[model samples]
Target: MPQATVMERTPFIKPNPASTQAAAVSDGSRIGFENVSVTYGALTVLHSFTLTVNPGEIVALIGPSGSGKTTALRAVAGFVRPSSGRILIGDRDVTNLAPYDRKIGMVVQNYALFPHMRVDENVAFGLRAHGASEDLIRSRVPECLSMVGMSAYAKRYPRELSGGQQQRVAIARALAPRPQVLLLDEPLSALDAQIRRSMLDELAKLHRDLPNLTVLYVTHDQSEALTLANHIGIMRDGRLQAFGDSKALFRHPPNRFAAEFLGRANLLPVSGLKPADEGMAQVRFGGIALSARNHHGLADGSDCLICIRPHDFRFSRSAAEPNSVSGTVLSVQWQGDVHNITLNIGGEALRMSCPPMTNPPGLGETVSVHFNPAEVTLVPEDGARG
Candidate 1:
């Protein structure tokens, strides 16, 4: 596990597991955005953002900075008013609601805990803000703290806690108010690698404990999204570029951006697109035939890019495979358990990975690499899918 990335360590986070679903409290607290668009003066920040987070589902919105992922989350929290359209929690419209009235809990990157407040007080703040009975706050504060495994730290102040502990307390505070929806905006971004890894598990457990708590998570970390979310929404330039079940979206990205942004990928230009048997399509890359899924049902003879993840490419000892291709080795990097390979395929750069190569091919040496047709998927060159 020394060199393992989050993706390598965790399976795609499943939708609410059976045990959690059975314990879930039914509330129709689904999160919805209907053509929600936000503008500041002349600049449009979010463009007609529309997506649904089902009750008990964790949906992550991910993208580069200024892509409106946070804007979309804030809109749901009632912090940023939409210039057009509406936002809803369950079936109740909350576009015009006050932040305190939205029944949405938000955890930010900074933790945002009151420095002078003890952990218990911080957890109690939300309930008080919502005008809960003192008895409710007393019981809820301890219950939420226990749920996050922070009941022992209830007497400690934020300054006395580590970053990871502070984040736990933050999450506890968010859950204290019995919110129908929780918005986590880069909640683990501030932690180091080790702590972030553990926090990811903590979050997954938290969702299981409170399965009815709908979540809209905004993050730039693809692995975190893939590890914690049942559904993922990839944003780009203030638009929802792609949204689907997490595993499906990663395996069949709708465009070049989604393909590259979701993971490390080699996009090779291909032409001569044609249908093959069993729902497959063929494209030619530098005179070499490549077959893959036609996710978009692209028209015949159209040009598009074939996306191959680094790990999907395997070194070929023989050219017996139908999907075999030759590449000139550019460089090979030994990164613990895996070999990172840079290759020249028809003059374009492609990257691949393999088990540690004890005697890696020398730079400029010709090498053969092959991939499964099922492992490769197509992305439209111009970012559109027909």
Candidate 2:
């Protein structure tokens, strides 16, 4: 086995600790998995998936359990091989390369540091194996430790450190060699909320410092993907559902599943479409005419589903208005910053989130609800559900 080695310090101050200058095979740092499919016997884990990680970009793969998010990360790490397709790092074809040969840094949620070693020793483990000069290892370990804000805990053992601290050590260890790509598999899932928040900040700072490093981050947490990733690839049942900028995906999801899966949504089944003024359409939602943004793909008098985010709906007085509905308040509950109000409309329960309003309506009372036409989306009703 090839030993991991730490880098030699040249004593240069980082203008931005979030950027990296690591280069990959082709010309710069890029990871591409084209038509990548992995199968185990008769079962296929990944299917004809194509993804690219541009240099210095952070892309997150998010999905539910058994969605193959981790499988994709492992494929890039060389921990698993594709039955077909190509895996390229920079300009190099590394489809068959060993994991250690790829020079990629990997951090899992477990923070798998060596139990017997101190923080500094664990960070230096890779460098020592790669036969780095003792002087280089000695000087680089502290630098890497400081990079993760774990320099003060160098003397502590893995058992002595908190989950977040141990995770930082793991990150420092992976980064010791200055790899071209960093793959994180739910790295914050194990930490408490406060620590996770801090670690997220540190990770974001690191991204700003490493300008040339490509990152492939896998997580099931939507908030993590939304906050940390420049782009996101949503996965479901071992297939890519949608991939694009985080804002774009959240603002205009391609389908109902994408909308509901990415965040809380009120997906209302529809029956027809009619022209409404002002670049909007009067969508015939079952027994209701709702004004919505124009959805070119939804033909006139065609059945579809309207996806409205819970946060987009607002409560109003019980009165008929365009793009509004009247319903009996089913229940209301306090959720710290907001109130989750459930409304019974046409025998269906619709949930909406609103800021804690003064003198909220009582349950069993009829109330009016309004949603912005621009925020209401139209998707094919038949195939909207998975």
Candidate 3:
């Protein structure tokens, strides 16, 4: 068995005396799941998941449905005990602790606000339940609401507020007790696109204000994960498929699932993988030879997939350009800022994005697309998931 590597807990920083909001922020907690697994009867929902969330860092767990993101969050909250392994919070083993003892706050998708309660009472619920003094609850309730910019609406009922406002109240309620960690489960999923964007900005501002607040955000929205999280954990089929810094993970995915899941990827089937100069390889696809950066030790003539992002391809008129391929435009869809162009190369369909300011090729027009060798990624053919 591999030895468990424990991370050193970060020391708590004192709040700045000049900022009143800093007094309401709790010392961030380091969370770790060591070889954890969750099961219900004969079904295993999470398989040997291991991850460590650094103190004061935001980590987002993202995947499709049944990927065990919520299950992992529940384990951290002590709502679901791991069938094996251990969970830790700031050096304390909390795997067997009750939910209320974990010292973590959670805001769910539906906002979960009490319909009959005013915003102030809703925010005070946690503190009151924790047996806080009446004076402390009164002070903490307004402080929390103020932190979320909801102090003006403290007397309004949940039904009287908009979706975004209610969500702000819910977040205030979660943070009222000053828990060490905050778990958000699709908190912005119910809002419209515009509201969601605005709320994302609000959440970012909140993080800035509460610099010591550790967050574990769960969502299937890749854009949200990319926008908010410092680290991203990609889950699939009860396992953590990929985990690392968000930008690095998206740029250099380890497998096909991650490459496709993080963002758009054009998986071009290629063969004849041979080493070229400058850490590059020569690959042949559809009778056209292309150069790609080769990190994987692919044997000569081995079948593989060349992964490229749609934005990496540039429209060209010359077939003589390096890594150039000619294809006929099949369809064009204009997005608000860019145009999505579909092309038929040989018999395979490929998607590319072009700037709206530049007119894309018309349907049935033959055009050449050029890609740089540095932008190509080589992966084994079998790395693709079903």
What are the TM-scores, per candidate, against the unseen true structure? Answer: 0.91, 0.89, 0.89
Give the number of the best model, judged by lDDT.
Answer: 1
* Clash-forming residue pairs, model 3: none
Superposition-based RMSD of candidate 2 using all C-alpha atoms, in angstroms: 6.4
For each candidate in turn, give its C-alpha RMSD to the true structure in angstroms. 8.9, 6.4, 6.0
What is candidate 2's lDDT per residue for 222-286, written digit by digit as tens? 98888889999999877898898998788777776688888887777777687667657776656
Give the alpha carbon lDDT tens digit for every residue of 156-238 in model 1.
99999999999999999887766678899999999999999999999999999887788999999999999999999999889
Candidate 1 residue 46 C-alpha distance from true site, Å? 0.9
Considering lDDT, where higher is better, how would the candidates rank from best to worst?
1, 3, 2
Runs of candidate 3 exceeding 4 Å displacement: 1-28, 295-301
Candidate no. 1 TM-score: 0.91
Best by TM-score: 1
Off by over 4 Å in 1: 1-25, 384-386
For candidate 1, the lDDT comes to 0.84
Candidate 2 regions off by >4 Å? 1-27, 275-279, 317-322, 382-386
**CA lDDT of every candidate:** 0.84, 0.80, 0.83
N/CA/C clash count, model 1: 0
Error of 3 at 338 (Å): 1.2
- What is candidate 2's local distance difference test score? 0.80
